[model samples]
Target: MSLLFVLAFLVGPPAVLLTVIGPPIRGWPTTDQLRAWLQQPLTEETLTAGLAIGAWLIWLLVAYTVAVRIIIRLRATTAWLRRMPLPTPLQATASGMAGAAVFGITTNTVTTTPPEPPQPVATGTAAFHDETAPKDHRDPAAREDGVTVAGGWLPWEVAEQVTAAAALVWLRRRRDYQPHPTHPDDTDLTPLPPTVTAVQAALADAPTTPPSDRTAALLEALPIGGLGLTGPGALSVGRGLLVTAVLAGQRHSPTTLIVTRATLVLLLGPAGETLGRRLPLTIVDTVDEAAQPLQPAGPAAEEFSPGQRPDEPSSGPNHQTIVLLNEHDGDEEQLTRLAATGTATAALVVVLGERPDGPNWHANSTGHLHDPHHPNMPTPRLCVLDQTAATDLLTVIASPDPAPPGLASERPPLPNAGPPKLSLPRQVARREPPHLSTPPRQRLHLRVLGDPQLLIDGEPLTIRRSAGLQVLVYLAIHPNGADTAQLTDAIWPGLPRHSLTGRLYTALSELRSTIRTASDLPVVNHSDDRYRLNPAHIDVDLWQLHATIHQAAANLTHTTTAWQAVLNAYTADLATTRTWPWLDPHREATRRRIIDLCAALAEKEPDPHRALQLLQDGIRIDPYNAELHRQVSWASTELQPWDRLTNNHG
Candidate 1:
């Protein structure tokens, strides 16, 4: 209503006055003649008559209505664009995908070292399938088409929608998509063997509704179309088309790309080393090795062909194989035979040189493809990946599978490890006061022990990006500071430093700007390429908790007071509800220490009731701890007799 009033005031008066002022200004009547006409009686012929006044009133209403509708239409379009799920180029890139990996979300094991003897810690596994269920955007069960195709060649709106829909579908399938289980603590970083589920996840989401018939045609032609490339950028162009086909393979019919290890590296750069293990790729050592049909091995082999004999031809209606070859290694006879087999089999085979009988596209050094055979046809833009783009995309594709439920099945034996010894430096412990000292209140307070939040004085400050908040949490854990590479590994694991330098820098810059804007103090300090929070300006609760624990360890005389302070400092588990891959170690370690502290305090308590309360606190954290349960039972027994005697006396 307020907006309408403002619009009316700006436009309504000017529009209404046009009727009274328009005709005379256009020379229908002179200024003197117009003034004289107003003095005339209410006659039908006069301009000042009642009929003329009524017509002008109707004109004002019509003009206002049109203006209001136009304004509304414009606003609606703006909002729609704002809400559109547009997948940026970054989203398809390696760093972008790394950020999307299911790190600690569902059920995953993380190794954390506590006090002296190492014990396997179980961070309670969440329900595996529940979190990965199909979101509201699209139904996962509606996978008639095998894999969604990457629609990078399509228009902006079309491409992003395709990407988002594909991601949702992949997530739905990922719940049941388990590759062979490998130990989480394995030292080897080599990519594992491929599985059917792995291939499906690597492929794009099948479109629920395509934007246009032309897009549909383009997508359809990608899997079966025998594409050949020639000229300066043939390898690059062919690589793009191959990646697109792999991403777009149908769920009912999957596509396997066969290429030599050398060619794969040339096509995708350094990322090729990891891509073969994640995507639907069968990488061989030589071009000769690529000529053979794919044989399923281990569990994947059984999943691929259950009843069929291994010696028989495994080709079925459900499989689509695309073999990528180099021109240098191919002969005329081999190329013709390969091309003929592809046509008969309803499969695709892409080459880096001109084929004898099919359409061969020419590529320029700038990574653009031109169809010389049919100049009139639209030259669909191929999905070209440079080194950085390849790394980012591979990282996204290589996102670790959601760990299965009931992880950490082999629990390490927990010996009666007495009270935890503080791992603080001797000099630092001596420098600390006997009692927990209160520092002057700082303007910025970063709390990460519970639900992570940053506040300026008392009011909560909002950080726009999740990465920005993550930086604060990571820095809070490492008070001394961390360099860029270390931060990237922690935040976006498996992404190369070169690919995500800008992303990391942007997060740091934005966080610094936000903090300075709120508190007018530069809380984040960067020098020698290391970033750290300025403790003088910003106060971290995690740091304070450690200090109190250290004070308790150093001064046994003030242990009772210090223990209480330690309890007060630890409000909850670190970054509760967050599932960063790097957070599990810190979160579990802190939780164990707190439980130990509770037990230590209870053992010393003289009053049975006080000891019972302390034991209850420990049980609240570790409900599965048998020792804590035993102590609680003993405390209850001690109190039972006293309560019965009092009742009888009353």
Candidate 2:
């Protein structure tokens, strides 16, 4: 509202007065009248009115600024309110109505004069009708056709109504359209296999014949209404279609749908039929039951029963089955214990709500007992099911199965094979390379033990462990050793003076062992108690990487060569997880070097495609880099012209 007031005072009033009163006042006394009016403007009444208008305009402008600041603060404080969920249509409608209301109110308050009708000129009249004609004016009908033939103030009310109505209609249409839902079934599922033939063959070999009317009876017994198919033949087709539809909806491969559907039908149909014929009515009822009672507990229960041993065969009815159900709570020890007791013949069911890393049943290859003491103990046949499927699967397992003629009279060999092997081709041995005969090169072998200690080459250098390594690395970095006392005090500030020498000896022993193992070079030598890493014997990749980076930095304008040099020097982060007091500064310096190289390449490379590729590779190493993104954006603009047209339009 204050903004409107400021606009009205500064612009609206001047425009209105000039159009409405200026022409009339100018004509009041012709030349003589204008001169008189200008002379009269020094009157007290005119000055008072002018001063009052200026003061009101100034106050309105200040008020507008204050109001804008208050609005910004209010938005900041209640920002979360914008994220609160609201019905889309209601939100759209409210927005539209608010905009219309604001436009209507503002337009009503602002007064605008109607433009005067254009005077038509007589083609050849002495009356000077041509002199009064509006410049670039056209007939009213032509203007009404939507062409702006003349310039003049447009009434605010008409413009407001037009804009508000258009906006309201657009909002209403947007609210009317429904957005499509993202169905989980629509996701790609093309990675499964089909086994229809296997299922049919299993069914055909069953010993007992199914009743002729069995399929019809089962269809009638189905809980769900209106299955279009009945009987064995119809049931097969219906099952196939149902499986296909489910798989298709899930976007799975057609082959996978066939295999999974066939498997399901074999399990639920022929397998169920064979079980039904053999089991007594009472046993069938028990098998179909939902939950089993937890086994009774006693002092003797802690020990395995004679037949309860995983390998022991039960002497009860051949069909009698034991179903073991275990839940994992993510304790590795508990999982190990459960796995140790399971046998191959025992049906082991594991119910897990979350993935247990490294120690879960899925991670076990043999599903064998986890203990060395029970190495020969048979492990259970493992079945993993989510919570919802556990009850049904458990019931099926408890059910008695009639020994179908082909119930594998003999158990098949286990499928738990050992590690996969590569097939190697026959080959002849070759002579050794020339470099193999040379004695091992003398180099520093740095060995880090437990915490802070470094062995330089093979000899135990007499220097503080922390200080010696720092001095060695610094020297390895600088190509020159530091003063002994200077290095000692740098690493061990405020140390007790007496024990410093003893501590330095221990540190030097560890450093010597480390350096000897790390390289075969006599890299470290003491000259007047000052230690240094022999630069020639050390094979540090850091030096090479840095040298290459320096070379690249020196030749930024010749980017092709510079980029190649940087690429050759690139390596995975140095001792990425290891931390040292001195390593951080070096790491940071290397990072800055790489960044500078990238900047130089970005500036010198004329081909945006090449630049974009370089930036992308850099991003892979440093994902959070902002400079890479900036370079990518610039390169994209350069590439945009190539994609301007499509062949289809032509």
Candidate 3:
């Protein structure tokens, strides 16, 4: 395509010239005659030839103008395509299914029963809400099977991304605001596992709005894990399919998968035994065991009963209980009875082969499912994971759950310190104060607490390539550096590793060159196959915020000033508008810390008006925090009756 443009640009003018001044075989002027006509002064023949030449020149100009316009349009389209995440239906479904799985595991509402509203704490400082906590916009949708986002079907990937992102946020909030007791003994110091972090990075730019009804329906209709497979290698493929479904189903809810022992080994190989024990899955011996009343798998799951959450109808899709049975194990009579019982209990019965009483979709080795009754219909492809992929996924699911960033000090009120004191402790010492007043003019400025921007000596330096900016952001997040594999996986998730090596190098080179040209410093340092930003040469705002937070913790004598410094340092949410796939967890973690900071500071403030203002600021940051709202109410009550009414109404 570019060659065609070059040909048109370079060849068109010469062709026109040859046509205008070639030998007179076709009534065209000879070169000598054209020269004579140009040399002549104001003759009619000269004017006619000149006009003819001028017309050709004008034609060439018009062609070039149209070509330029077309080039611009093509470039614009190419950039748009690069920015658009979902380009295929299969990828969309993968994202949605993965998102749903993430949602299931990370949802905050995880209890056997609907919890009552939170009452005030005994100390009267601030009462944290339990299950009755004011829900965020996406919390309800996250609990359901389908997550809806605003807009048409075109942005359904955004819907899925939003679901995954909301789950992550809820998970973090739960860890921060409402720690669950289900895994009381489970403790891992790391903020999040690699799989969860990758998923968070994959869906970082999801819209803040909750999914819309139309979008939710569209997502629900996605044929993620098809009903059943019965082709040549149907059982093998079906195992992967069923396993995928189980993973997705049990993630956020207390869902269970009941499979026979033989079928479990066939599905997950030797790992099945370990998985069955670890996951909320039950491996049964025969059809008789399958028919027995099943237990709730996880903390949120409840036994399928008559009365639980009376407001919610029994028919509603509250939770899932899937039963996987082999054709050989169950007789026709038992299978029929089990199918009926499954329907009554809102359970799904999946058979290994074509069952007369079950949903039997045939699948080929390629993972596309076909309805035997309607062969002419379009085949929906199932999300089939091979042994390796499925095992890896299960391993991630089995990994230790996360603990919130700062779990040790998660109380609502600030610690009991009388006031800022003048004396400094023997062990405590203060470093030089951070440059909080203004951004340093002479040094490199890397600001990612808002929109990512790199400024050299106070002047904006654009990193022309998106990948280049991504490299910078990745390095900013991991100051210690990242190897080639980590960088590729985080930046380009599912792309072939071999194919991305060159592109990765180019992005890195471009980043280094751009920074070097602007600042005359090697911003990116490569050592031992790992790439990181040169911390000595550059000053990142995120790092500054971290320092401020640490200082606040150490310097208790200057409590008020220190807390305010932390707030001021956090200019905005980390990388505000930019939605890099890997930024969501980091962003949410920082946001939660800030909210905690505000609440703690407000609790310590002695002045009623000042305390109210502090709590209000925290509310602005996180409006749905029921604890913050309750604190606001408590603070308002401390004022005089008239002031209280004015504050409440205002």
Best by lDDT: 3
Best-first order by TM-score: 3, 1, 2
Q: What is the C-alpha lDDT profile of model 3 across 1-650, one tens digit per residue?
A: 98697668667766766776642235777899878867876898666667766866776787788789889889968855644333245445656766665676668567554433333223211121221111211222232212111110112323343335335544545343521111112222233334334333433433344433332222122222213448865665555445444544544354567788877777678877777666567778887789786432342234234454311223344335667877777788877776656555555666777665645777676455677665675564444445554554455455234555775434444334443222211221223335677864357878887788998877778877767777887777777788999887766554457757877888878778877776676678899999977776787887777677656655655556886797789888878777555666566656666665565555556666777887788777667666677667766765678586787999
Better candidate number, 2 or 3, judged by TM-score: 3
lDDT of 2: 0.36
Best by TM-score: 3
lDDT of 1 by residue, 1-650 (tens): 97797677666655656555443233366788667767864555564445555656676686788789889889967845743444435434644445444343334455553223233343221122222111212222322112222211222222333344334433333222211111112122222212212222222222333422222233333324355778877765565555554544432135566776766777767667676676666777654466567332233243334674322222444335677776655667767666656555544567778776555778775455676755665555454444444444444445355455764232321223234344441221112223436764447789998989998877889987667888999888888788998887666543345756888888878888887777677777899999988776777888888777666655444446766787789888899756454665566556556655665555545555666786787777656555566667767877799678878999
Worst ten in a row by lDDT for model 3? 145-154
TM-score of 3: 0.52
Tens-digit lDDT track of model 2 for 1-650? 97687666567655654554342222234787457669896777556556656755675676688679789888855743642233345445656766776666668756665344334333221121122112212222111111110111111121122222222322332222111111111111121111211111111212222212211111111111011111223322222222222222222221111112222323345353343232221111211120122122333234334545332322222211122112222245543333333222222212222212212222132111122234453432111222222222212223233334743233311112221121111211222224647765544333321222234445544433334455555554444466656454434432334445655666666666755555545656778767765544554445566666656655645667776777766655543433332343344434444654565455445565666676676666555555455556666775676445433356
Full-model lDDT for every candidate: 0.55, 0.36, 0.57
Q: What TM-score, over all chains together, does every model reach? A: 0.44, 0.27, 0.52
After the best TM-score superposition of candidate 1, give how far the Cα of residue 251 lies from its true spot, in angstroms.
6.9
Q: RMSD for each model, in Å, please?
A: 23.0, 39.1, 21.4
lDDT of 2 at 459: 50
Error at 633, model 1, angstroms = 23
Once fitted onto the true fold, the runs of candidate 1 whose alpha carbons sit more than 4 angstroms away are 1-225, 241-253, 260-262, 265-280, 283-319, 365-367, 387-411, 417-443, 449-452, 462-474, 482-531, 544-650
> For model 2, how big is the CA root-mean-square deviation?
39.1
